[model samples]
Target: MDYRRLEKIKRILQRRQPDLTLITDNVNNFRNLSAIIRSCEAVGTMEVHLVNNQQEKLYLINKVTAGAERWLTQTRHSSIVTGINHLKKRGFTIYATHLGDPEGICCAVRTLDYRKMDYTKPTAFVVGSEKKGISEEALENADYHISIPMMGMTQSLNVSVATAIILFEAQRQREEKGYYQQLRTSQEIYEKTIFEWAYP
Candidate 1:
């Protein structure tokens, strides 16, 4: 590990608070889940909600997260519908990202939001499976629906790759606005997570 780069990242993490939450709605592959966990951590997300019932599948995600899964929090849910409602009740503006249209998104988040920062607010984002895309429950419950524009012959990007691209753009925009200027969490959480992330 590059100590300097790690320090730089730690500093950015100290100040950078991205108002993003991830929901895995029936995504079937362990590799994709692990990749998504990697992307989520890289982009500064610490909590992700998983909606899966199978114990075998959840365990498979450990292989993909590369133990970064240990650095973040994961919640299990029986239904995506219930999760969306819960997030909404907490004042999160739930966004469902897909490949269908270019007009609705506001920034370049999991979907784009055109508005400026109220960074202290809570937000939640949902990523769909590779083959089926966003589910109907997410679509019905989300406050906004978004898509990434593609010029290639391919219609959609891989789920993990798409997650990294979208999340980094959100991080990039947040960083410029001095979003990471202050520590957001308790020092205990900060120390514990950083140490676990570095040493584990």
Candidate 2:
């Protein structure tokens, strides 16, 4: 690789947050999944976890992902419970997206403002399927239920849009904490990732 391109890859790898990630629960739509992956990449997220119980395989739309999937490491799980358990074992704090107290009815899990949460720590945002929202199991497993406040008549945002919003908020917080100014990934992984990203 040329010096400029190699340097560019190193710069990006330097800012990558290995601890910040996303976990999707049965988000079957390939377009939505692709967009989520793209957003994760934009925010310097190095990996993403997926729960795809309904389908045998998960596919991505190249047009939506815009080649961002190639730069990310994706882990697929058979169920949301399995995915949550895996992340929890790794010391990741789970933040499941949920709109609690809809129509004045109290939800079992209370919701917090997404902006208020600390994203600089090892964090994972759990976004649910487009149709059903987050499953009960995911909500129960999450360390906290978070939501983006809606102002108008609309009740919810698109899965991809919501994912982007939350991920960017994390980017904002991480930026303020100077997390992007230095290399957070280990030296071995940093060298490996930059080489792969440059060569691939």
Candidate 3:
């Protein structure tokens, strides 16, 4: 690779947040999925978990993703429960996006101001399908239910747009914490990723 391309790859790798991630709960729309992956990549997210029981194959629109999916590690789960369990085992604090009353179902999980939460921790955001919001299982398994305050008549934003908003907020918080300035990934993984990105 050229020196410029190598340097750019290294710079992006240094900013990658290995601890921050996202989970999609049956987001079937290819355009939305691709856009969500693009936003995740823009925010330096290293991995994304997908839970789609309907289709075995996950498709992405190349135009929407803009090749961003190539750099991210995408894992498919059989169910939302399985996905949540996997993340929980890996020490990821999941934040599910929901618009309903925080205390409607149960008081255990309360909706918090998205900006107030600490994104510096090992965090993962869960977004559901376009038609339906997050599943009950996801909300139950999530560490917190978060929502963006809406001012206008529209109840919620588009799935991809909301994902971008939340991810950018996380990017901002992580940047303030100096998380992007230093390499958070392990040396072995970093070297392997750099090799793959530079060569592929």
Candidate 4:
């Protein structure tokens, strides 16, 4: 809740033009989805596009996202391929979260595990549940793929926790590059989100 830092984030977002996104491939867990929403807010992402086959669980999503959902604009679609198409239409370089081959998540990720990333352009991150990770459609559509560097004996982080690490790392990187120092949305939307998040 650093106002100055938020202001700096605004400037950085404007200059770097980082459109960090979280895409779910048939993610059925509301808690995990909700946690991802919270992480997105912490990382200065204004929007989230969700792809699901059903909408009956909207109330569940709202509950899990809590009030954080108000600050983050979430859009939904009927399918993963449809969602990917939408993001691509908007110029995002879609990235699917898959197990990498000991290579950096992206074309130029760091070895530091939590290295700073550059989000100066449109970037979309895709995450799936452990049971089904990234779907075939999502993997096929992604421009790049990434996986967590698990030094421990365990194989993975919970979906939500993994999202937190990945997004915060991107956020941290964007901070260093000063990507959040610019305005990415209209003043009306910005003020509205701030007021809701600040007061709610």
| Per-residue C-alpha lDDT of model 1 across residues 9-85, encoded as one tens digit per residue | 57855953535678988777789888888888776777888886445447546667777776568887888998888
Q: Write candidate 2's Cα lDDT for 1-200 as tens digits.
A: 89998998989999999999999999989999999999999999999999888889888999999999998999999889999999999999999998764233546546788888999899999999889999999988999888887777877899999999999999999999999999999999999987788887
Off by over 4 Å in 2: 101-109
On lDDT, the stronger of 2 and 4 is 2
Per-candidate TM-scores read 0.77, 0.95, 0.94, 0.75
lDDT by residue for model 3 (1-200), tens: 99999999999999999999999999998899999999999999999999998888888999999999999999999999999889999898999987754444534435877877999999999999989889999998898999887667886789999999999999999999999999999999999999999998
How many residue-pair clashes does candidate 4 contain? 17
Show the lowest summed lDDT stretch of 10 residues, model 3: 100-109
Q: Higher lDDT: candidate 3 or 4?
A: 3
TM-score winner, 2 or 3: 2
C-alpha RMSD values across all candidates: 5.0, 1.8, 2.4, 5.7
User: Which is the leading candidate under TM-score?
Assistant: 2
Best by lDDT: 2
Higher-TM-score candidate of 1 and 4: 1
Question: Which clashing pairs does model 2 show?
Answer: none
Give me the runs in candidate 3 sitting further than 4 Å from their true place.
Answer: 101-110
For model 1 the local lDDT of residue 64 reads: 72
The reply for model 4, stretches above 4 Å from the true place, is 1-18, 60-66, 103-117, 186-200
TM-score of 3: 0.94
